[model samples]
Target: MLLLFLSVLLTLIYCSHGDLIADTCRKTQYPLICISTLRSNPHSRSADVKGLVRFILKAALGKANTILNLANDLLKKTKDPILRQSLDTCISVYQDALDEIPIAIENVGKNNVEASDNASATFVDADTCEESFSNSPFAADNKAVKQLAVVAEDIIGSLG
Candidate 1:
């Protein structure tokens, strides 16, 4: 009887990919983003909670890098000194985000609680970058990075 119960429990824990993804996403603050992003990745089908957190952090890092590139390009093209200063600040923040996200991913993979703090730092970096482009063409891009970073932090925090 005990063996049978253990088998059933294992089945539930390692159920269909959709079941795992849906259940995990529901626990996150942004269910839609969590579900969609996890489902889009083939590896998420077999990944557990820590793996999911790593996936989110990596995705956030990619967005940060993209935002950094956009800021750099805009800075090169713009002539306004004030706008240039804002872009420079944004570029720096994005760079910091790029550094923090990888550390978060690594720590999460190791099951270390410090991952949450690193994720929070990335969110701050994204938030700071977004503030620099409040009324500029890159505002949307910055906002997207901020959202991704927030989602990453939320997922990391959920792990605890």
Candidate 2:
């Protein structure tokens, strides 16, 4: 009987929070990405809307760091001047993204609406980086960064 009761309790908790995750994700433009990303993080089960925004901002920061590293790595490996120039641009924009994400995370933690605008800034950074790679080999990495920034921006926008 105790085991059965525990199972039911767990189910109730999951179902309730699952609904919240689903409902909140629906507000974003990329509902599927929002749902999957939130559900993948254990903290999302207990997070309110502001907490969710922070979670996404944290994720965006990590992605920005990764893309920045990729640009740095590619810059080291290439000999082409044009590609080097593009990588230089990507490196600059991604560094800006890295700087903005932490501010967004902090603002979101404080429940400041400026968090949304900060995320928009990150989105612009990603777009600039992606555009710099228009003919470069590292386009895919930059595209992923841009998409994550958009996801973060969309999720934050949903809060208002």
Candidate 3:
């Protein structure tokens, strides 16, 4: 009877431990999938895509800030010159990447607003500006904005 009780107790603990491990793994994969989907659908105008991109960008920026804090903590905790230098470099690169996101987003917003304004100004029978706007430099800038989001994701992964 004693042996059976011990075995049952151990089995229950092992099962709980496995559950904890699985939950952690799931959490980690969730963020990766979320980021990847955002990066892939950055150009989408659908509400879902836009919301996902905004959420992912916010998450990425938050993570980047956390890394910066970690680097600062490491600077205080470690005396190794090489490690310190590497951490400094990581912080600098992360800052640059984060800084670029705002500019990219702003450019995209400006382009979209300008495009809408231009489209509205055209006479009901005028299609020339509408057609030209579709292929304008602003459209190309929109593509670049999406690419920048993907790059930001990559940068966040590297920082991690």
Candidate 4:
């Protein structure tokens, strides 16, 4: 009897895990990235949609801040006007990304059902930074920013 109970319990656990993450990930463009990113977070194991969105947005905000700090650091290393201009622009992009996050969080909290998509700045801010450095010597600076932004946007889309 205990063995039978254990089998059913294990089965339920396996199915719920799929339903919580994998099934939700299916709704996004980057399902593999979504599953991998969310699953890596300790809080995600029991997170519902709002909790998942909050975790993802917070992570993305952290990445945006990192990008901002990296750009500021790069600015300190150079006196070149062109490089400084590019870095400043990239920094602004990350700042915008950071600013948008709070609004997205609030919109998610509203539970409007349609607000999350419209509320998102998504990958636009990151894309701007990436494009600014695409032909510059600062392409290396854009790498992490672009990757994190894409992951953030994908996760946000999955929420809706």
Tens-digit lDDT string for candidate 3 (1-160): 9999999988986665444333322443244445453445433223232233344445444544555566577668878776666666545645554564444334333344432222222111122211333232223322333333443333233322
Native RMSD of candidate 3 (Å): 18.6
**Residue-wise C-alpha lDDT for candidate 1, range 1-160, written one tens digit per residue:** 9999999988876676569678777876777877777778888878987888788777777778887898899888999998898889888988888888888888885655678788888878877776775476666666665666666667667666
Per-residue lDDT of model 2, residues 20-75, tens digit only: 88887777777776777788899988888777767777777777788788889989
Descending-TM-score candidate ranking: 2, 1, 4, 3
**Which stretches of model 4 miss by more than 4 angstroms?**
1-15, 109-119, 135-160
Structural similarity to truth (TM-score) of each candidate: 0.83, 0.85, 0.41, 0.75
**Per-residue lDDT of 90 in model 2:** 78
Compare the candidates by TM-score and give the number of the best one: 2
lDDT per residue as tens, model 4, 1-160: 9999999998887668657887767666556756777788977867777666666666667777777888899999999898788889888877877777767766664653433543345467666776776475445434444544454455555554
Better of 1 and 4 by lDDT: 1
- The ten-residue window of minimal lDDT in model 4 covers 111-120
Whole-structure CA lDDT of model 4: 0.66
Error of 4 at 119 (Å): 6.0
Superposed Cα deviation of residue 11, candidate 4 (Å): 7.0
Instruction: For each of the candidates, give the backbone clash count.
Output: 0, 0, 0, 0
Instruction: Flag clash pairs in model 3.
Output: none
